[model samples]
Target: MNAIIDKLKMLKYVEVTASWLFANAKGRDAKTFVKSPQFASYPEPTIQITSPDCGASPATLSPEYMAGGDGRLPGLEWESVPGVKQWLLICEDVDAPLPNPICHGLYLGISKDKLSVTNSDFKPENEKSTRLNGGFYYGTNRLWIPPRPLLNHGIHRYFFDIIALSEPLDEKLAASKPTREQLAKEIDGKILGWGRWIGQCERVWK
Candidate 1:
């Protein structure tokens, strides 16, 4: 599938025309992920989320973190919020040609003491890196999935959102590999604060 998309992207006319046609269909801002019954009452992002490797919001994400490269998670740091018992990070691609932003990664069960996460947190099998220790847990999604935007789809925005929770999720709930719907039910009224950092990536036709 990727090979076919790569070939199509090489056709300049096809790339230009399709990109133009889909321009308005790039979907809503990735922040829309928070527009749920669970988060509707929370104020706009108050915490500051930043990536040491990606620099800052609107930064160009390193190629190594994209799907075609190493697919490693980037190191990220965020301001700690008072009364935060747990943290959740969810990365979404807002520019995908879909009704909703596509989730690239979702992590939960982060301990209150963990204000930042290094790329190593995603590499449990590597000898140099420890398993996602200190109570971190993967949500329904895999530990992490690199963003795989369509070639010639123009620039895509990846939003890394950190949600501060007033309570830690029950261990039993985390073990169930809760889906988005399940999570919404569980965290409703528990959100204390939110923050987001964005990185951009695109596959251009040469």
Candidate 2:
């Protein structure tokens, strides 16, 4: 067992799979697994999420706007607000069919100077190096997976949760994109304020 763990530790991608298997084996409800309750537990909304990419809650997102399509991150703008040292952005599909919500993208430790993120910022090539010097860290969608919701899974609610932190993250925490649990744990009572936007998506064709 120790040997297996050691090997898994060296392979982050496989580690994600193994953990997912264990979490879903019992058939836990989607909400129970998809979200980290700790992260969900917050004071209240402080910053405002801007829909620089599209209109407020479109009726249905077309294919080209999704993973199966161009796979580009939509443009988004939000305020740095006050009383915060860094920011975090996460795009999640809470309505995913699986036990856990699918993470389309995650970025952390954004400098307060940013103010907004554009589609170009989501480019795959920017991956690790993007954060190496920008005082930020980007966590690629889990396993480089895109936000391709399976058709007939029902309309998915994608949330862009933007948070402001009271203090700068430690070197380790800011080094990479944090997992849901990690985000919850790290932000435990440390969040200053937050805001979010919801987008609806559904696959219409087979």
Each model's lDDT comes to: 0.78, 0.63
Return the top candidate by lDDT.
Answer: 1
Count clashing residue pairs per candidate: 0, 2
Give candidate 2 misplaced runs (Cα > 4 Å). 1-44, 58-60, 124-135, 140-144
What are the models' TM-scores?
Answer: 0.84, 0.71
Worst 10 residues of 1 by lDDT: 125-134
Steric clash pairs (candidate 1): none
List model 2 lDDT by residue over 8-114, tens digit each. 55665554444444442322224532244544655456677767667554435556567768765667778777678888787777766455666777778777778
Which residue ranges in model 1 land beyond 4 Å of their true spot?
Answer: 1-21, 125-134
* Tens-digit per-residue lDDT, 1-206, candidate 1: 99988886577667567777787788577346587767777647889888888797878877898888998787899988889999888888889877888777777788899999988775544433322554566666466778766667878988888999999999767755677667878888889979989888887756
